[model samples]
Target: MDTLCSRMLLFLGLAPFMTLAATPPPTHQFTLDNGLQVLIREDHRAPLVTSHLWFKVGSADEAPGQTGLSHVLEHMLYKGSGKTCADEASRILESIGAEENAFTTQDVTGYHQTLAPRYLGVVFELMADLMSTARLHADDLAREIAVIREERILRTDDNVDAAALEHFTALAHFANSYRTPTIGWMHDLQRVDAGELRHWYESRYAPGNAVLVIVGDVTLAQVQPLAERYFGVLQKRPVPRLLRPVELQLPGERHLTLHRDVATPQLLMAFNLPGLATAKDPHTVHALRLLNALLGGADSARLPKKLELTERVLNHVETRYDERTRGDSLLLLSAELTDPPQADLDEVQARIWQEIEALRSTPPSLDELERARTRLIAQQVYARDSIAKQARELATFQTIGLPWRLLDEDARALAKVTPQDIREAASTWLTRERLSVVHVQKGGGR
Candidate 1:
């Protein structure tokens, strides 16, 4: 442990933004009478400010039949609003040398603007109008739908890994809305109309359900007045509570093979796990983070060292653990198998399973555990350097109903994680019955 910690400290000393004592902490928050939450972080090192707005509604909150309504509305928000034309908003921002964009995820939708301090007023006005007074035109909706369809075709239809991942998620959770793609099923998108999109916009885009996060070369005194002038006038609505469906407990192991025409064979193994917000113990989340770091996170990780270096059975290997907004999460391990004889497939599967089983039976070495903690801490410090990343992390925590401060706590917690906790979490969650294995084969049709 001492050697691992020392190595981590040495690495942190050399990496950018590792000197946390000099970094400013975010500290201001206020709520409007209408229920909009506002958070402001002051950093006067630069002459620019980043304004971010987060809406709590996401795919999970969409109406049962309207699978991709949240995402569709995200596109519609930019069509036109109030005095702005379809493309006028972009032009307005560009004229001021500002950058703006929006994205929708499983649990939240966000819009952000980064510009010189002089354009802060412009940023606020544009966002407020888009959020409150967007007028969706019929012709614009038609054209945007076409664009979105094309995006889906390019992103999912033509891409092998994207298609496989989409299918895997859909089959992984039976009752959860996470099963649905954010872009929505093609059939659902085709059936969505302008009226339905408008209704979704009005219902979910309420001021009460939004949060305003501003970070950069400004203070609360200067920004709060501007925020009130532009956003405070918006009326609030009765924001509906998010109702998440319960996912049935996995009774046994589930295996799915999705064959696609691809250049290489890909294997994805996922296990059901608890999310950060609802894990049996908060330490479980930290342990899982460390465990993933040791397994497939770094170039020196276990799977890469074993598969790529020794066994030579895989060309590439990686793992990801998503502590999603929902209480149910997934631990995914993917590998691109080497070109081998047909008889070698079973051996490859056995090797991967053995690694998983080993984690459950034995704890990670003292060195491996320390290295993982250091890397995780370094990531947290690095993330703080970008205003956009800081905003997103803060918004993600708030959206998931976790304390925004947990961002810091999570990093610290990782440092305290012990080997025993990792073994226990693996034994508890990564069971055969709770796992889903997906195989993608070349030249094999669905």
Candidate 2:
């Protein structure tokens, strides 16, 4: 079970970074009187418009006992507001030939709508209404809890990869809020009644904690009046400043083994690394991303080519550097063992380490670095093809207190990384002392 879980983590860790090559629309940004930040990106290529509302709060902001408050609040936002009833917002949206949805992640919660440009005001009104006046009625809370429970079951319980990643994170950040699942522990959810949810909503869901992002066929001058009329008049509430506790730096490697019903062996490894916020650190995060690409990101990456293609000891492999929401991030490497014997597993692990050591000792050839950079750049260009992606990118940055301009900055940074930088990053951050390994195996020992 441990081995299988680790392999699953690897698969997820290496999922493609979507890219879009087409030129993005011209964007304008501003702040409302009540401290709500707004960004407008004008694109006349299509008559449709995308509206996104990003809240600064998410899973990491939740209080200790209220594990999934941000996620639960995301669902409840659509339940009812000042003038809308449970699910009525969806009905109205569909009636106007629009699509709308919301999602919550570790760092932010977002609500979005895409519709013909004419419906922009309607979209804004609906979003503003919900943001200021969501009603967490008892019956609605009760019904949605069941829905979310099922969602949790489907995502974390039924799916092996998801379960393993969740467990891996839990163990990886033992002292941090990131350790908890965003969907929350089932037990925690049971205790989150309507009153508790309402308290959470009142405290965190305020204009000061939000940002509005729009893309498609709208200019700053055109949308500013409507935005002011709809969103500006809301009374400001005193939102408490976020104070994230610092985590003690991990000094050495940590290992854990988990058992579950599974078909093959898996290994999950994570190493602590500095986050993107600290500029003086030489952008190890980006270099680690490049390292992940060279090691196991693509079909022809080192792990796949060596383990699956040549050695035939592993069926698949994956590696990634998670750009964290808060505090330090992680560089993860995961793999599946073809045969589950202890000796073989140990040997496979050694080979993985050997590959890392080689990369650390010797800079990648110009060709290898260029190829990985090209692939990464191509993926970024592809992800920008849709207005949805543009909106998501902006929301993600704003949610994490980063300037949306960082998107371009990151592209430039990725371009500037040298092969020597990759080697240095690997040696410094990917050291064995900073590593944690999780192995998933079958229930009974061999």
* Reference-based TM-score of each model: 0.93, 0.90
Report the C-alpha displacement of residue 26, candidate 1, in angstroms.
Answer: 3.9
Q: 205-252, model 2: which lDDT tens digit per residue?
A: 788888899988778888888899899988888776764533446656
TM value for model 2: 0.90
Off by over 4 Å in 1: 1-24, 244-246, 340-344, 444-446
Alpha-carbon lDDT of model 2: 0.78
lDDT of 1 at 432: 84
The 10 consecutive residues of candidate 1 with the worst lDDT sum are 14-23
**Per-residue lDDT for 95 in model 2?**
94
